[model samples]
Target: MDVTSFWLAGRPATGDETFSVTNPYDGRVVGEVAVPTEAQVEEAVAAADAVRAQAAALPVHVRAEALAHVSRRLAERSEEIARLITAENGKPLLWARAEVNRAVSVFRFAAEEARRWSPTTQRLDTDPGGAGRLAYVSRVPKGPVLGIAPFNFPLNLTAHKVAPAIAVGAPIVVKPAPATPLSALVLGEILAETDLPAGMVSVLPVPNDRAPALVDDPRLPVVSFTGSVPVGWAIRERAPRKHVTLELGGNAAAVVLADADLDWAATRIGLFSNYQAGQSCIAVQRVYVDRGVYEAFVPKLVEAVGSLVTGDPWDGATQVGPLVSTDAAERVESWVNEAVAAGAKVLTGGTRDGAVYAPTVLADVPADAKVLREEVFGPVLVVQPVDGVDEAFAQVNDSSFGLQAGVFTRSLDVAFRAHRELNVGGVIIGDVPSYRADQMPYGGVKDSGVGREGLHSAMSDYTEEKVMVLTGIDL
Candidate 1:
């Protein structure tokens, strides 16, 4: 496949300086693509600005149809996009395919949300004779949104921002992570074929250095970014005037209560925590098992972590793949090593290859260690023993990041306590921390993120509510 350049404003554009997308398994060049310069970023922004009104004016059903078409196209070409994703991102092929399926779900959910946002009405009564007044609510576009998606879950994360923006008649300029832009480019091409107006949406691959020009544009009414905490903070500082939906970093916690079924929780937690090499915002960063089951859970987890097949991402049987780049793998290795040096116990799998780290399990990690505090963004899970549910909640809420958390408990009281005391955005019960439905209200609190990105919730984030009051005695 030729990854040389991409289509911008309905035209193919290439740059002089090219960057190679490497296969992380063996460090081979999968393809080479050109990174857009600041000038090209400006072109994309201008293109989106030019067609904002036309795109926004389309009827709700029309918009829905166009988005549904993209969904269908994505489903039909799922394997191809999955291959591209695995090639560029180094995720297992099965995981990439699953992500493509999730992407389709995002479009479907957004399409449904678009059809539901049509004008609505209500009657209001106030004071004397004011009872004759009428009031109603209507939706208005927030104008062109600048979507900056990260490498992790490239398609779904981008869709979480763009799908909702487009659903609410807002145009978008998407900036995909340079390391994993091919799937987004393919979707951009599919979108261009829809009834969407010219320049309504533009997908441009830009290096990290060029992000400021994309985020700081005044024409962009809202800036939706999904990335690390530092970058999200910087974007907020730079674009203070622009509305932002930042899906930032997270150090998610999973509490395995005493009443929980160790067998069931262990299997599902292993699947979720280790999936995608644990390169997700909701990945299980901290596991707080009760003292009763801590001994039993530790061995079960080590065995489960040992079972993951790590190798070439293209292979269907592969469970874990390399990190997006060698640098990412090395960073994970360093964090794990630092934690071990600081007295953390490595129960199993703390080795690393070029962009590939073994599914590592650490016990008794110090709270101040990078492995416990910062997001590892690799397949590494830290296990700690908690005195009880209260201590579990305390330990979970003791972090600056409050994105999401999970609890495995059969007791309703314990579950409710986790829900109430946990400082994260969503607290899952009987499931791992890595669960996210496309239609649910999804986002973070604190430094994790701001705003939300599900179906209806995201639509609301991309739109403004206007109330129109009419008098019965207007004449």
Candidate 2:
């Protein structure tokens, strides 16, 4: 019976029609959100357009101060925010708290980046013809941005969109995933307390049908989306004129080389592959092990996965919780069943109950199997043995999605080779692909994503560079 309203035009706005926000754990109604009509979506966009210049006109220090204030306020209510994330997204309480912490860091990074925002000055005297001239390359906001985020990691992902826009002084309209809009709405509530201009930030929880209004709108000059490939690409196609940054799905892989520390690889891989029910974009999905250490690594991986506690997300001891919905769990079960039918061996943990799927580990799965090739966005991991590092690298590169790949090797040469040869956005050394620092340049190659999403990278994406030249400058 908790009722949440959309943050629209600097205030809370509600509609007559409302939708139930259910807890994925026990199918209980946790809250209700007002669903906006298409007209309201248009109004929100116009409001954001009206204030784009106001946002851009704000001084850098003021924007930085505002972001810093939000960061401190979020820290004060970290527990409440964590519980909100757990309630809607089905993420474990520990993971939810970590997400909040990362969000706070994101804002802090934005605050720092905002204060340091400046143009690069290039001395034109490098060439004789360029004597007594100076060129300044500076970035400007790309008008209003349309941020479409996914249900997984709702708070941090929304922060990834909003913080950068705030850092660069661009107005942003966030369309959080309908299933988990409460977190974003709460963030909007906090933002309203800041000194930001009216309509600089708006969180609209509308149906998917009305999403086209936000995506295809001509006024919004930039679109930043993080979600599935099909939807992300469709948004790009529809908004062909806008500056689009798509962070899509990935079937991430990791290689365990012959020289790797088997215990280290086994323990890290097991924990990451099943973390948050494997809902993350870069969660370790496919692990390729060198045949020399396959036997020693498999048992340890199986044992690690088997030890995870799966149940209610509210439990402090629970490591794995239910997926976003029962349908998501069923899809994961069916994919595992399909893989098994194609001669795959289930090493351990392949079962589903309601929306809860046990952490599954598979071996010898066919390369064409859906579980191996596609983004099995569930708690499933596939283990394939290879004769050597070359074969393992090939297997990792064989996927259509290449967000990130991890190579565990003590040899510096092998690490360099993997770093150079892997067709992924990032190559992790001595760990799993699930490892991500909040401030790194994070995105994928191929279908994984289109642009980088670290604080600085995202600020760059939300801005456009212009060159200012002085023809008669004395040094």
Candidate 3:
């Protein structure tokens, strides 16, 4: 089989060492990708640093057109890209297709945003001393960006980093997760089709160990990372003087109130908890149910989880697939076993075979169990009954992760209260926490990490404001 080309300075290149990407379900080799050597990495960085000024000075129309071209090409090749995603990452075709569609929208949003992104004028005539003075403020790139993306939702998350950087006219170098580099390599292919500067984009499948040096490099002043909590925080600490944005881990919860549509809540929670093999940062991990409907909701949730088909990712009927590796499955198995030994009752599933762990539901989980307190990045859900709205809200807030939460209530007042009290970044009323719009400010607080994603929000993160004062201007 042919080795996939890594993008260096918007062109295809190869290195001395290469690694194979395999399917998690069958362990079949999906493809091989070249790992960039030290010299190659330096060259990519040098190219981006050398072109920073030109990249930032690019006309808005140029950036918009390049982004639009990528968007159109993504739509045209969506199916092939989805297949590649499944082959390398073990994501089901249904979810993989959704990921590609989201990427399609991200680039389009970036294009639209680039077209109308203009400077704002503030008149400084409010005070007599500042009369006839005008201040024009515009956002400019901090410098070339180092975007480190995770394996789950590889294409869309990479798009989240790349699209925003392009929209703001910032040169970007993307370091895709080693497990699923194919989807991102294909994105570089689409980017190469554009008329943008060669140094504007580079996708390097650099090994995880080598990425820290890239993060610490002085040439790249902006770093945007989306991955595990420990790694994201470490990158931020390593580059304290740089502009860093971290979108880290989450143990998202869904609150079921007495008045919520119990059937709707059960269905959404069951699916989202196991979606993408529960690899997403906001994949439902915790469930706090009102005691009034706790018993009723438990059965419905179990049935919903049991109904999902899990197998080969390529199968259109398969909804849940394997974790990225058998090691991940083993870790989840250990966590589940620990919870069970601590007196947690398995309501539905508590089994694993090879790389795939069954969609699991646990009731009466102890407060101190790792599955409940930490981000369980697997297909496991822990349910605990709360007495009332106060307890429910409190349970949701009793965690280090404040990424997002779902409150399934029809009452406007309760929804408002959830929004006000839930310590998460975004509260979803009548839905699951996995819901995210590509154009909205999406991020978390506390241990979940800082900074926001989404086209417009990320553009702001990648750039800083530069104000020009016009003295003695006639107002």
Candidate 4:
């Protein structure tokens, strides 16, 4: 199956060569997609530009209505989209279906947010009592936006950026990851069916190297990117004028205290720690176990992690699926091996087959290792012993990446201290680091990302503030 031919507008551009989408489970070629060339990207951008004039001219109400129509259509076609996500991205079918639901919710919330957008009113005085003036702040559209979505949560992340831009009357050019472009392409089809008009929302599957051109293009007024930190920074430097919203990589930490319930903590951490094969941005990358419970926690945690069934995501019984690609799988494996070579003990699951690395757990991982310091982007966790809560908090705050962190604790003071000093944007009281809500402010501090994402916050990012002033009024 090939989706490159499914470009939303302009001529269908496919190379003589096709890029294969390999099933990470067995390295089988499940489908082939078109490799878009520079010319194709130009055409797609042109098409989006053609629609930009009309889309920007439309009343905000019209855009909201179009988005509402899209939301309804998406809900109706949720199952089909979910199946495509499963086939293309290799996530569990159940999780894929949940993601589709979340995508639709994002659209719905974005539409509501757009409908409620209004400028703030303020009083301004030009002179004391004699010459008075009134003023207010108005928000204007930021024009066309480019949404570069990653493979992990393709449909939802795309929706988070694209839906709001369209709702607020900005044309969007979406470039989905090559491995998981199917569902996003399907979303484009649904958006096309709405009154969105031609060129308003263009979905193109472009090669990785050619993506910079789309960001560098002067036509785009804003760019919302979700991917690695290096690429995000590169785009920031290259697209100097465009407004940027980046959700970059993170090395999330989860701290388990000495007094915490071992059974409950072990089960919940095991469940959430490996969700989506541990491919999520906020998934726990480092676990700082208090020395009091280190030995006791290791065996139970290892047993829980090892018991997980790693196989096809489509299979209902498969708790852990393959990583996104063989390269990613190998990267995770090599990191674990290096750690073990450096005297880190493998508590359980130090193995890999094709793109499926078993739910791996490591103890005594050094703070400098890539697996502990950087975003692993796989189903692996590193365990380290901390003297106490303060040392654990210090270790968690030691990294440059701080998206979210977690603490399994009973004391309110410890939880509050973790919240105050963990150096992360979010701190979960009794959960792992894999927590996120579409309605809350979501982003990281330091190098993790630039701005916040949730429904309202995203809307704010895509707009500009202009203060309208009035002078020379008789008192």
By summed lDDT, the worst window of 10 consecutive residues in model 1 runs over 1-10
Which of 2 and 3 is ahead in TM-score?
A: 3
lDDT of 4 by residue, 1-475 (tens): 5445545552344655667766556666766776666676677677777777687678778888888887898899998888777777788877788898988888888888878887786666534652477777877677788999999987998888888788777778888898888777778777767776677777777778888778889888799999999999999999888899999988788899998888777876776668788899898778889999988987888888888877888787777888888888899999989988888888788898888888888887876788887888888888888999889999998998989998999999999988888898889888887888787889988889888898788778888888877676553
Candidate 3 global Cα RMSD? 0.7
Model 1 C-alpha lDDT per residue in residues 1-475, reported as the tens digit of each score: 5656665765557866778777777777887876766677678778878878887788888889988998999999999989988988889999999999999999998898888787786666646656777777888878899889999888888888878877988888888888888778888888878887777787888788877877767889898889989899899988888888889988888899899999887777776777888899998878999999999998898888888898888889999999988888999999999999999999889999788899988987887999998888889989989899779899898888999999999988888878788888898999987899989998889999899989898888888888988888432
For each candidate in turn, the TM-score is: 0.96, 0.98, 0.99, 0.92
Instruction: Name the runs in model 1 displaced over 4 angstroms.
Output: 1-3, 37-39, 473-475
**What value does the lDDT take at residue 146 in candidate 4?**
90
Regions of model 4 farther than 4 Å from truth: 1-4, 9-18, 35-37, 50-53, 126-131, 471-475
Better of 1 and 3 by lDDT: 3
lDDT for model 2 comes to: 0.91
Q: Predictions ranked by lDDT, top down? A: 3, 2, 1, 4
Pairs with backbone N, CA or C atoms under 3 Å apart (clashes), candidate 3: none
The backbone clash count of each candidate, in order, is 0, 0, 0, 0
The TM-score ranking, best first, is 3, 2, 1, 4
lDDT of 3 by residue, 64-168 (tens): 999999999999999999999999999999999999999999999999999989999999999999998999999999999999999998999999999999999
RMSD of each: 1.8, 1.1, 0.7, 2.5
What's the lDDT for residue 224 in model 1?
A: 89
lDDT of 2 by residue, 192-286 (tens): 99999888888999887788878878889999999999998898888888899999998889899888898889889998998889999988999
Q: Report the alpha-carbon TM-score of model 4 versus the true structure.
A: 0.92
